[model samples]
Target chain A: MLTAFFRWMRLVLPRGDAILLAIALIASFELIGALVLLLNSKVSPVDLQLARTFFLALTAFVYGIYRVNEFHPLAKPDYRRWLETTPWTWRNPLPGGPVLLVPQDVVVLALLMGLNRDFSFQTLYIPVAFLSFYLANLMAINWLLGEWQLAYSTGFGLGLGGLVFRRPDYLLLIDLACYLLTRIAVQRSFRNFPWDDSHQPCAPIEASKLKGDSANHRLGWPYDSLTPAKLRIGFRLHDAICFAVLLGWWHLTLLWGADERVRFLIIALPLIAYVGIPLLRVFPYFYMHRSPIDVWGRIANSWWVIPKFDCVWIAPLSALMLNFLLLGWASWYEWTVRFRYFEVTLPTDWRYAVSISLAPVGTTAVSLALFLIGPKLEHWRLTGQHRIVFQRSQEFTEL
Target chain B: MIQLQQVTQHYGVRPVLRRIDLTIETGELVAIIGPNGMGKSTLLAVMAGILSPQHGKVIIDGMERKSTVEHELAIRRRTVFLPDKPWLPKNRTGREFLMGVGRLYDIPDDGLIDHVERLLNVFELEKEGDWPIRSYSAGQQKKIALSSALVTRAPIMLLDEPFSGGLDPSGILALKHILKHQVQQERATIVMSTPVPELLEELANRIVVMRQGEVIAYDTPTGLRSLSQCTGPLDEVIARLVHPRTMENLEHYFQERPKC
Candidate 1:
């Protein structure tokens, strides 16, 4: 019966991990027993108990990592490929292993919790460590696959749990909600099996024979050019999710009374990204790449601005101007600094909007300038002409 | 088609390519003749995607070069760049290198092996072909490198200083004929940078004479001769166009009387 129960406790762990886990089980109890004997007035019993529980939690974190590594189809490219070739659907059990959290996973977590249980809420760390590790991996898998909605949901949920530091119950509730959502994410993601370009960001297996690194092949011309990994896809709808999360953090920080510098920093960090990203794009688009007929050159030669092609600059210039105008408003109104005074008191509604909404609102304006308001790339390529000139040495003394 | 638009390349603050905009259509064999340090190799390197230009895009076959994974892989498979000094597997034999390169481009084994053997005979490296690259002479190494590029059967070829790489007279003749056959028979696009324009006279569809990182003249051999107002050899026409003061300097040298 004991052997059967132990077998039931094994979820995603392989033979090596199972053996190591047995050793860890021995270590956990031995360390606790040793600490109890070695206890002194200086080392409190509570600290000893906490240390023993912390060891179990750390092990659970490792298990969480292994769980995702072994369980997720995205983690195993070979299995994923095989699954694609087979006439398999989400309805059937995966040929290799389970996708969703199984009863065995709960038994594993419950076993860890049982080992270090103190009847206090502090024992929640074991489950949190396991699930946090699991969901974090899930979040990354989704993020890499471009499921930004799920990624941000897990990220924001995890972040919110961290923010409510004192409440274990709130963390556990959020973790449960995240787990259920992850199960939904798993189902949704699995439905799109044999995914095209599903990025595998996991650690490489050192022993794999057929697998080779970048160093193995000489990625020279045409291959290098045609397959360059450097293309930037600017401002997807997912930017809105990230922008909301940043602002949400700001709101939570303010409502919960974080440090003044920290409060300002949360908004300021993203504000830099908002302003800086568009500036980087617009600057490159204009820097040396000028209109075939510049405003000054055209005004001088033809005495006309030439709205036909010159309109290309309007969106970038407007983004810049709008940024300055918004920044100027931010400066004059003293939105970020005003929060210092409300260190203990509750912030008012319009002021909250002005201060907290600054980063996201500015980002939206900038993103719209880049994505929505455009002499679109396809149109610009077919029509727009640019005057290109660079410094060339006239004196050639060589044969 | 290979299009370079507003491409600028530099080393430190010194510009090697200054806003180079050139389009080489399919099946066109263009020769880049320029003075040393005048961006001849740099131009080929940029088009080959060995180096990304600071300010523009390289569009090939209606796809922007290096823009995406598929585009890059497709471009790589179709294009082959033979640098002046190509890195060879020192431990591998010349035939092995050629076969490996052919296989890399997914050429069938039977044909690839036959092609490697034929390339070995044509280049006159039949004996050295079986010997490791480290055991070969510089000229023999160049032959193998050229053969490697040929084995790929790539539609687009970028050869930087192909004729200057310690190639023997027979090897040079073989390469010239092979390049001509590729362009004429196979309709391959080749852009090669060679200091010697005389070698490219009949082979070249067009010649771009570059001076101080600038394309001073880009036209057919005849057009270049006429543009420089010299109905002489391509070398003289390019010399007149690229270094107009060289003749004047030579005249001054000849006119001067030695006091001693």
Candidate 2:
């Protein structure tokens, strides 16, 4: 019985080198804890809390990344190719072993819980953080691999996480729900076993080294002239909305759950998203592009706008305005979030969380809508109200 | 057979190809001729299914283009369209590109490699075929592109500006004979547009005369020759049919040349 348990532990844990690394990490943390004790009679409550939080967050992140990498075969080309040829299905014990959490996982969590036992029920927080990221990443992979179900795992985990500070009992239900839902999503994804180019790591042709002499290979306009650039077929409006809502939910949870310093990280992200995304995406189509007529020429001819071409900018511009409105709400509303006021000890209110969350939603929405709502890239490039000038390297351009 | 029924296309308010109605039989070599901006390429594009006509339909083997997924795929398998500046993969060797195109058309693997070699020799690209297409000269690029279209062995070939894109004298001559052979032996229907009236007269079974986005005339070489009332070769007659006042324009152009 003991041998069976040890074998199960071997399957659950990291390899030999990784195990040594984990031990070294725990020893370093213990050293830090000993230093605190040596310096003072006892560590301050605030310092103790901060140290535990940082360590838990770090451990959970590493654990989540390790599991996602190990359990997922798509990360490794050899495993993925082998799985494709095999008759093995997810119904069988994964050949590598069970992907779902077992008693072995509980023992690992129990060890972590024992280490950080000063805080009451700190065990629950470790599981919540580890499972949240693990499931979140898996669900994303699952969605990419063809399963459409998303957010159920991370949503319950992150949503209940904010309330966990006051009500730890409620988190137990979420932990259970997240695991079950994620398993379903993973099972559905596995059903799409023979994954295609969408999920598999695409071999970069530009970086490819073909057989034969690499000399005399030219680039640029050669390929572009033939295939042409059609920016039309990417993400669509609904996809943007879906992505935006998820980002917003993440922001909402983070705001309610984190300290003042972490809240500042989200502020620049949305702002950068608002200005940066549009410039990167929509501006490229219009930059140095040959318009059939200038603004003055259009005005003179009474041809005000080219709907097909002009419509491309609508998504980016509307999303910007919407983001501006959201910022305005955050700045002026009941629970105001002011930049550079982190030192002032501002109140962390529910209204502030909801207001700030809108920015992430708007930003993600803008980026996606700009990409997807289209006269397909081919249609736009071929028949757009512009001329395509040949570059110096371009012998000929087909538009 | 390839059929275009009332095909009209436009990018904006202004039309590129105006309500074109045309029929091309199997094994026929048709040439589209017109002045610049007369929609020769646009009409060909509509027929190639690259551009869907705003009005009317393109019918190939009684299967409408882009009508249903299965029909479109089947039609695509049986047809090959080479734009004047068709793209070539930069990293791929010329032979590799040809092999890829052959496979795309579902040609048998055992036969495809040999066919690619023969096509390379025909284009005088035996040595360069081992090199990447990106390193090819403009004329060489044109030859490889033409070879790619030929390698498909599709029943229908739509080539736009094949002669003028960039081909040496020998390259042009080789293409003329290869297209003729494809028609005579393989029973392939070819529609090409070129400024070279002499080449058109030599190879084309029928001639399509276009002007201002419309097909003004469609007939055989002898029929067009007689219709223009020219006793000499079809070249001079082509000038008259393409533009009615060619003699008047030439006389005036030379007379006005010194003054300008």
Candidate 3:
């Protein structure tokens, strides 16, 4: 069974051992860092608890995503075809379709538990609830429908229940019940697998139901859902909305007489959500859509050109607008209201001075950086080759 | 003329087409007949610009494929390559898919609509045309894919196993009449690969027989029959030219079977 699992892993990961080694090295580094953090005496109990919960929840979320992707019926039709036609049968124990747990998962769990020995039973239940929920619906009739939501909700509910009840005994009972139910459902699903029924013709009535379901229809950004121009406009609109919300929250925090730290944190949310996330998503599109034909020469050039052009122009403008809004809102609030609820006062003058000086400068810096590195990054991504930074030593041969 | 000049292709280390050279003239119906795994599909793919050959070039109407994006696009506008297993987008209806293909080939909207309706009727797929391609059976999907190719009205049509994929007798007869009309009236050039050469013997102007990534023979049906000294069907001539021991192996296998 272990051999079969390894063989399956090898088949799935054809990029060879380099990727596996990279993953292992990264995991080891994270574990060592986590252990060092755990051993520190200055670390507060709240910080430790937060770290533990974040890592555990992150593990559960990553595992849930992996399982959903692995079990998605339409994700890899070629792989499924190969599996169905191949002579190899699942050698894992019955009732548990296939043992997809990798060595990294076990190592991560062990390291996490070892670092936090005094962890509550709820921390242990987090992974169990998530895994059970995924297993139950992994082979369900409508596995695609709300599978991620179910897994996440189960983990969240279990963790919350454990915290509220403050009773490990009841939490254990609930966990056991969930596990048993998952086991029975999985066993039945495996016994009568719906391989043939998977290809059932969807009824015409289902089409109407899916008319408004953008989640199901979203193939990818800027690929199937929207044209390049539309995607650019959509991103601009999204950034504008984020900017408005952030400014509103900042004003609210000011009105409530929050401290400097909270105010600064509130302002950072829009930067992360709008600028960072959009930049990350735009790279692939940039790489895919770069073209030799410019806008003037050809009416229909590469799809990436418009999006890239929009990013270069619109992103900086949006950032500047957000900064202006922030500065303007602070000025208005300072002029209109005087707060006596808290000791810390809003530094409206310094805020205005910093916003005015830094807004255009920061925007210009970001724009320049994007213009300079964006195309290079796109090229590097498309062509999987990179020039060596240092010259190789002639005498350095394989040992 | 569509010319493959010393074209060679390899999937990994295994060579599928080994320096194949062939010229297919305009309005010519060329049949690529061979045993399985003999690079017939690879040849068609190279010609269609779907797969780039490792060596040599594919030239269509004096424009070399892969020389420039504009050149490749020009060739694509004039050619329609139907792969053996056409991947139809599941969410789209058959009519929508055909129309999309027509639009891609820059067919006029009015002409495209009329052509799609005619194709659906001719292929007897009018009932299934409105449904999503996901709900289509293997045969219906093949018919729709064929309809898409026909809707293009391109001068060059490269079909890989058009008959073997799943077509009723009537659908096959309709396709035959359609291809014949396209070749004679529209002066369209066609290159199709098929395992069964009997179907193409009467229709194809020239037959190219391949064996293990190399062309063994390229001649007219009558020329091949005379060369092989076989008065039987084109399949028999193909077998004798490419796989002489196929009949012997079959006889041996049958003799080895236990008496019933």
TM-scores for all candidates: the values are 0.62, 0.62, 0.45
Index of the highest-lDDT prediction: 1
Sort candidate 1 into its docking category. incorrect
The local lDDT score (0 to 100) that residue B222 gets in candidate 2 is: 88
**Model 1 collision count:** 6
Model 3 pairs in collision: none
Summarize candidate 3's per-residue lDDT along B138-200 as a digit string, tens digits. Answer: 778788888888988989999989897668899889989999999999999999999987688
lDDT of 1 at B22: 89
Tell me the number of clashing residue pairs for each predicted model: 6, 5, 0
Q: Order of candidates by lDDT, top first?
A: 1, 2, 3
> How do the residues A243-309 of candidate 1 rate in per-residue lDDT, one tens digit apiece?
4454455345443443445645644555455556565655544433455433544444453554534
Candidate 2 per-residue C-alpha lDDT over A12-107 given as tens digits, one digit per residue, 9 for 90 to 100 = 788889878877887888788778867887677557655775586578667877788787876555566677789988667676655677777778
Q: What docking class should model 3 receive? A: incorrect
Task: Tell me what fraction of the real C-alpha contacts between chains A and B each candidate also makes.
Answer: 0.03, 0.03, 0.00
Model-by-model lDDT, in order?
A: 0.69, 0.68, 0.58
Weakest 10 consecutive residues of candidate 1 chain A by summed lDDT: A390-399
lDDT of 3 by residue, A340-395 (tens): 86454447766644543443333333433333333332222222111111112331
All candidates: CA RMSD (Å):
9.3, 9.0, 20.3
Give the CAPRI class of candidate 2. incorrect
